[model samples]
Target: MKNYFWNMLINIKNGQMAKKSVIIGPRKNICESFLKILWNEGFISGYKISPQNTRNLEIFLAYTKNGKPVINSLKFLSKPSQRIYYSSKQIWKIDSSKTFIIFSTNLGLKSITECKKNKIGGEPLIVIN
Candidate 1:
């Protein structure tokens, strides 16, 4: 999951969006949620479940008018062996305008803003800048 997200961000930043879409593999529920967040945040143009392969998902990366990638950076805050959990009270803004933090809660994967709005929290997953 770590390398997949990191590589996707880097590829998009390195002009892979020119291809219009990128295919990501072998299926994971969390990837779907992350892609949904990217879409909602306008970091991606669009995405869809792959019809050719149920295990694969297609992502449409976004670019600026001058053709620069929309995502600047992605950081994984919690490791499998060293997880970081946060309560709603512990959640704070991490560059609300340019960055977003994803968390895995009992309610499922949610962003910091969403968790704060809903008054719920969980393990912090990744931060994207």
Candidate 2:
């Protein structure tokens, strides 16, 4: 019984030591540009979704080769208004154990602010025109 309990405790501890992941939402061209920065800085190991394919808010989730959590993007439903609703819901789905990054341009400031107000883990990285 003692050995079994110790084994269980070890398993739990290992699970808790898992690295956190990240989520990223790139809603504008400038946001996409900053993504390159994140990638270069090694702050994010990998990323899902692409700016070129953001027509419907369907973004990607990136992970490290070692399976470490990295970054993710928001998905969109039909219609533009649905984007807010879907993005909010997606933000809520973000794992608390992971980090979230939101990339937005000047034009997307309002949207990023709203996301922040909603408790989405994102900050505006300004893009100079």
What tens digits encode model 2's per-residue C-alpha lDDT throughout 33-117? 4444545545345455645665312223345677743432222222222322334556556443344333332334334334646
In model 2, residue pairs whose N, Cα or C atoms come closer than 3 Å (at least 3 residues apart or on different chains), thus clashing, are 23-72, 24-72, 48-60, 48-61, 48-62, 49-60
Q: Give the distance in Å from residue 51's predicted Cα in candidate 2 to where it truly belongs.
A: 12
At residue 83, give the lDDT of candidate 2: 26
Residues 52-89, candidate 1: write the lDDT tens digits.
88777777787778876677666778877888888777
Q: What lDDT does the true structure give each of the candidates?
A: 0.72, 0.38
True lDDT of residue 82, candidate 1: 88
The candidate that wins on TM-score is: 1
Q: How far is candidate 2 from the true structure (C-alpha RMSD, Å)?
A: 16.3
Residue 1 CA displacement from its true place in model 2, Å: 61
- Report the error of model 1 at residue 106, Å: 0.9
Clashing residue pairs in all predictions, respectively, total 0, 6
Candidate 2 global lDDT: 0.38
